[model samples]
Target: MTKAFIIPLLLWANSTYTQTSLNLKPGDTLTYSPRSDKPAWISIQSNEANMVVALFMDGKKVKEQDDSRGIKSVERLYYIPEKGRKYELKIWAKSYIERSKPVKISINESKNVDILKGQFSPDQLVEDLHTFRAIREQVNSGLYVYRSKKQIDSIYQQAETETRNSKTIFDFYKVIARLTGFEGSCHNYTDLPNHASYYLTQKSEYLPVTLKNIDGRLLQDSKGVAMPLGAEILSINGVPAKEMISRLAQYYFSDGFSMPYRETIGFDRGMLDKFYIEFGTHKNYVISYRWNGKVDEVSLPGISLENFKKLQESRHSLSFDKKLMSEKYSLTKEGEGIYRLSLRGFDFAVGQEDPAYKKFSVFLDQMIDTLEKEKIENLIVDLRGNTGGTGAVYEKVFTYLTQRPFRDSHYAYTKFNEVPMGEKLVITPLFLSNGVQDKNGLNAYLKQLYPKAVQGKYYWADDKNPSILPNEKTFKGQLYLLVDQRVASAASHLASLIKSYTNAVVIGKETVGGYYEHNGHLPLVYELPNTGIQTGFSIVHVIQDARNLPDQKKGQGIVPHIEVHQTDQEFLEQTDVYLKKVFEYMKK
Candidate 1:
């Protein structure tokens, strides 16, 4: 791939109009000004094999385009240009760039401009309404997290009522996203469908600053000089910031709410941008914020989309706490007889070229060897930021920690034995077919259940067999598990297993993807036929015993034995607040 570079040029100069062009490579940027007051059309044609283009208007990303149908992606934005206002067009190859592609970009006064106007036809709006209803039906039937069908139906109906009154495609996107959130299932989300994605990209605008819900307050996270660091947000464009986030949160989780999950997904740049577009695309926002216990208001101009994206990247790079969290999966010596092992994720494709998976295997082997060689006493398994993948990814780690038997999950159940697959509804299969062959009796039982698999009926594993495999080098030490809300899916299952089968004290926030009712194994994505809004749901429902709490309620998060919360001071200082608590406990 070629290195990044930017070449800027002035296109034309006249009393009525002025234009600029930029030659962009991977990670490169270019800014241009619209010269005329009339409606302007910006067009892009790139020669790169797979290029993704991002369009920013008045400092906010309005649209993005990607390669399509054997053609390098071509996209055009049409909008009434504000004279002397600047717009940005940035391009890069999605994977890698062998060489800089020749891109032809131009801004011209449009002759026929009504097509750029933002309004869907009555027929198109009707089609989108039907699509939204279908999406609601699919969620009501397939999602395994809900306790009852009535609960799911109620949430879908709310979305249905909103969809019926929706006029534009952007309005439909907002409503569908809200319903997806109501499902309260992580990994299930909605986005602009392919047919309508291009039309809205050129017109949408978003709130410039990125935010995080910290201490129940919306705080601006961008390190830009214009905004105060960790400033408490009060309102945006006259609407209360909390009210705005509450509305946006509807598109994420309905129940089983995780703060980390909500802030990360709900308050992201794209969703915030879509929210503003769905409401109204405004150039400048009047924002109210609080700093040092005093309230203040400012008219903040929206920053470029690329600028906001770059800010997030910079924050991760600069944060010391995040640096300590990264190693993918590694074992490190903190002090004599004490070691900290960080396992970032468990999502592995088993036999794929997964570095995290390969490293986890190697790390476990080395950890055992080290434990055998040294008189290690405390081993801290860090699962703080793990969002989960495959549950069996850490089977070897389990072997070194246990001497007796270990049950991964109590049992798994599904609403349907045979569920239809694909958008085309091809390859319907029984739920038992999704089971992995780790246990002997359970594997055999699953195969037998395959023949008796029935549709639209709940099915479950009959066998509650425990896996018994102790590694030769079993470490007899005090095991400590470090976890937080980010620990989810299979990672959450592993947390439950550690508490259940091994002698370990879990320390941190209550886990979001809990033992009794978190969904996994195999998930399916479905696209609404008419509007093309995509949503996904998990088929298998797994129940595992909470390690320390024997009587934990269904869908309840695994409460930590020693709860720890990050103070704002600790966060800014990049302190290991959770680990510090563990250190103090060991000394005691």
Candidate 2:
């Protein structure tokens, strides 16, 4: 029952945001006892002010903010089910903008008593089957037509395969996870049997000479050219890339937002070791890809997974700018007190109880106070990296900043028609339940509409039908927000809300969250490893951010009010040129 030691570490979506070490901006750090038992609660001290932290068991609630605690004191409480491998701890933070981090948390379940206490039986299996079936129906009914059929067939096969394989549901679920790997949907995962931990790393066996879509029709004889972020499908030793693709897809499925098939097609091999490429189950050839988008084909023996990873890391160092990260992260005190704060994203390693969030919170509060204090003529509020965080925290921020009756503040939205609750699809009145002085708040009603939705629980980056704004007494001074394509989901909601303000100006790129509206999801199937099947799709289209009436076309995402974007060259320069221009305007 015992083996080696493991620790819970988080792999933050660091690529989403820029890392800036500045005065007005903040950083992060953490505090936790090393020898804690399972279900251990870790204390976090974040640098950002006015943030709220909460924990979840695979997206279900564990903890949240309280009056006694200032900000993010109780960061996350992990349930360490005794899996032999490891599961990355998923922790989310809601600040001026929302962010998330995946950390490694060790589950100590080797104790004989612990094992005795944790073991599930045939009765437990029945319960799991019942739970999974009910959830599967919910997920299946709401899919976007085509995705629905696939989900049904996938689940049916996984269940059947489990019985035939004489495998536990746990082992079966792992196989189901393999098929739906390209989805890039987060929190959509399966567990291993007997709480045996599965390693997230590519530490297991692997191939080299990664490749993307090859028309076995054309490249059957030749090894495919390499590009950035490409996948290794086959080995020089004639192993199929199916397993490899499945594993790689599993990693991205945590993404959830993008279309799976298209992503697979556009993949590039950024860095891969010199291994042979066995394209399409047959002919083998050696391959090399240069930094300048050039391909080199050769006849090589083989490469190890470790060598592939090292080569990829080396290539990443070459492709990703080093100096820019250093320069961009450097902060300069813009002015007295009112320092310009512009960083990319929220970093948990920066710590749970980070000062950056606190400083930003204080900065926001003081900004309002300063407007009243110095009788300042104008104010420029830039919200670029703000993803939606603890919805309650935003409630406080919005209440203080935009005070008035939310009678006129109604957000428009459309619901997942499958639920067929009613024709009236609206979100503004719902989220802004108790805005008016005379009313108690529509909070109770919204909760009833979607039972799973809770106040403190984190919503997706793009929650539909979010909180309503008070159109009355909005900031008259120039409130300019600079967005990029990165402005997504919750960020999109906030941007749209700000634009709805009487005098606010939204400047920057379009948002990445879907244009219509969709919610964060939980996978329905338990999965069986080795089988090419899975059940996945949204349970409900629960719209959080939508406009009046509806926009039926669901492919593209939302657009910005004052549209702006950097050229491909400008983007490569790693300059927020639009941010730069916005600053130029603020100077005036």
Candidate 3:
């Protein structure tokens, strides 16, 4: 149980979006007994940058929010105090980073309220530190692959000691975050609980300039008050930029020791806050940067979080047209006898709302029909930025592409014969029956496909390998697949299929999410009671049998056949370097 003490204080708060504050400290659970005669709305904001709040009505959890970083509210509650009805509000730190950080919850109540604030003493800090140990235990047991047992053990052992001794909770969180990244899984890692995004934009502080990693160098991509654009960063504070990047990269990993993926996110604005969480938050930064082959120093002031968020949003507004986030799939004619098929995602609901949008199966069948009818000789399938969806959605893609029966294998672990109720909440409801639309028709089929659970962890084989034959409308043409590091999950699964089975040449950078193994499909979120630290873990281990596929890496992404890398200049100019390479290869 968490060590907590409640202060008996009755305060009146106006029913405004932002007003009234409740003191909440780490390792404490505040039970607020709110009294109202009628239905009311209460706005809640926590000082914990990364915290989880569960709303309970008389001890039953009614609502829960994880990865909460902004001011949130519990709306439309029926609380009749005259009828002896009561509502309890509980809040706690969700990660080691959130430990010791005091969060002020802003509550706007329709009626005058008596709020109970939970405060934790310094003595309770070690109880919160136990969260890190629990996290380490869970990760070590369930992760598909990690560093050698000794190495992982050593890292956790060091983190445990540091967590216990560290006075600042944020520093303790950084240790565990680094440990999580050491596993080298893109899907794994602990989010900084004290991130600035958790606070109100007006109250939060942010770095003055925007950063970008180009050609492996961290550079100023936008203009700052004192720094010019395209300035290469030499150092942050007193540490060399390269050294800082290496240190921070430990908190972010993308599938099997890929530094490029970390480099790409190194430019993200969120990195600014993450940096502060690891190091301490500062008001001014002395940056040593290089521009025009000459070293320069600049003192930049930090901007308000609201302003920085706007700046980041404005950057995306500039490149609204280039992104392929819309529509599940689209096919277009780029040239005579050549086609470009952009498969952005594999979701069933992606384009289904549009009256003109065809079903995914219909779209693929018609795409093949168009290719054959138009006598298309070359096809470029753009899988760039596709993070993947239901495996059943992409299974249809392989059904039409395969020339013979295809065999795929996976190993999974579960606590029961079917998915547990709590774990099922983690899966998309649309994918509950493997994307089958009809409940009556798919009930028996789903029951058969659910993997049987065993007592510990054990390997299992896929029993169903459907015989797939290429359709008559299949286009016998030169196939090219466009991929990038953003290609993940089910998308990576699709890439592995084409590269292994078909004559298609994969182009662009290596995909994210492992080519041979991934741990997902069902993720469970657990909150440590003592500290309120929360984390999500994949309950199942998915390993695709790639023995038939040659030149596969164990815990790495799918390597492209014809590598097409982009230059820093090309990226700044918004040039399609990879597409150009594809066209050039076709010409050859």
Candidate 4:
């Protein structure tokens, strides 16, 4: 949980701002009246290491920045100010600190230039890299789960070397992206600040064509492009297709060594933005592809972000039924004796009384009644593209599929008993409680759940793991599980349980989430002191309830019994390849 600090409301009269900078002590409020209706950049410099500065517009908190471990003297915040409008700036130390030094605050008209195109000094980039590594080491429980400490140190060294010569934030992002990928946790990632991301999306330089990774080849999946559908792309610009894919793959991290997940996830619907980030803004792209057994090259102009999205919906070949993709959960009859349960995600509320949970309960009850009435013999549980959500939700789903009792995990633990770097941690609305904010609420919450938890030791979370009986009306038929690279966390946990305890025919590629274990739950995100780039990783390391099966590999996602990839024909036709394979298996 984030350490929440209370912002005291003080009545301040609007005053015409004549000075460029203002001095502020703890609990002091300074109001500035902007002369023009334009965006403004605010920077605060503090001798006090743990001070937080909050900007309020029209009595609403607009932005907040804290001095992060004194990595930099000046902490920056951005907001759009209207003419003749009053904005208030307040500074205060965290709850634990009693005294703090005065801070210097300054505001200036934001430049019209895109912040994404802005450059940082080589020293600043390297310092931010070190800060990034420090934060990860302190908070990430799975930092060395897949890669050794030496391997991680070498990755950071290489990143430092690359960051030293970096010109722009995107350039620095590439270096950081590689390190994040090497970290080998899907939950870990680095991204530009919100303001910078907003400015980037406003540009019309994103690649127009959407591509899909099929059988290790980049194939055009969008219409209106010069290349035909399913055209095998050989290169973009001067970079070979293989090399480009390899570079872009580093921008995404998957659990363990799931190479397919890293290679394929980046090229999905949001490929345009990923393409723009890896390869800089381009007005046009020179793409070479092999069409109808002939190598052809074409120069295609880039489209606006809006137009690119339009094309994805209107012309994308792999677009599924709108209703199917939008719903959280649905059950439909696939054939005379088979039923398809499409679980796009497991994001339902955990509390039984909560509307979300109640709704899911009603849906499941209705689904079971229909299945029993129809005497369905074959059931396909589609867990494709489900990144995961509430743990209780998936556990509920598992009860219907399994005959034996089970538990969600063998155990789960975090690196620390209290919030690490509480001063630098970002405070969100979720952390707010009655008048007082405690950053150590996470530890307190955990202690409440597990009274035996001790400091400097792994809390055996499942020491009292009582066996949960299967649902009384559980399905007593042949079960087929459909999963892919996108299945993760709770979804993957469910898959592991089914594979370990029951007889189910699993289809599709290996899941990106680990089969036996994963570092998940209670993710912590922090911004780099210099670059302001946000990095997040999970803190809880979990040993899942999975058996030592021959097919299940260590430090890897749950491998499907029958691994299936989308064929060229399936890609072009937008066919359900995994479902087709299931039907094929049933015919035998």
lDDT per prediction?
0.58, 0.35, 0.59, 0.72
Which scores greater on lDDT, model 2 or model 3? 3
Per-residue lDDT over 3-105 for candidate 3, one digit per residue giving the tens place of the 0 to 100 score: 5444344454443333346666545676655544466655444533344556776678887755332222122232344365456766554432212346665
Candidate that beats the other on TM-score, 3 or 4, i.e. the better one: 4
TM-score of each: 0.70, 0.43, 0.72, 0.79
| Pairs with backbone N, CA or C atoms under 3 Å apart (clashes), candidate 4 | none
- Superposed Cα deviation of residue 568, candidate 4 (Å): 3.2
**What's the lDDT of the predicted structure labeled candidate 3?**
0.59
Candidate 3 ranges beyond 4 A from true positions: 1-106, 109-144, 192-195, 199-205, 223-226, 316-322, 348-358, 407-410, 414-455, 458-472, 545-551
- TM-score for candidate 1, residues paired by index: 0.70
The candidate that wins on TM-score is 4
Per-residue lDDT tens digits of candidate 1, residues 356-425? Answer: 5666667688888887688888999898878777656756567778876666566565554443322322
Model 1 residue runs over 4 Å out of place are 1-145, 194-206, 254-260, 268-281, 316-325, 348-359, 415-418, 421-468, 545-551
What are the per-residue Cα lDDT tens digits for candidate 4 across 1-588?
222222232222432122433455544455544443456554544433234668777788887775332322344455677765677666544322212334454443343323435468999998888888888888888888888989998888888889988988888978888888787787886776532333365567767677878868999888766679888999888888888778778888878888778888777744645666777667888988998889999997877866876776665554653544677888988887999998988876744566998889788888888999999988999888888998878888888888888886777777776767765564332333223244566557656444445665456445444567788788889999998888888888888888888778999988889888888876666667676666778777888888998877777888988988777777777788888899999999
Give the Cα error of residue 119 in candidate 2, in Å.
Answer: 22
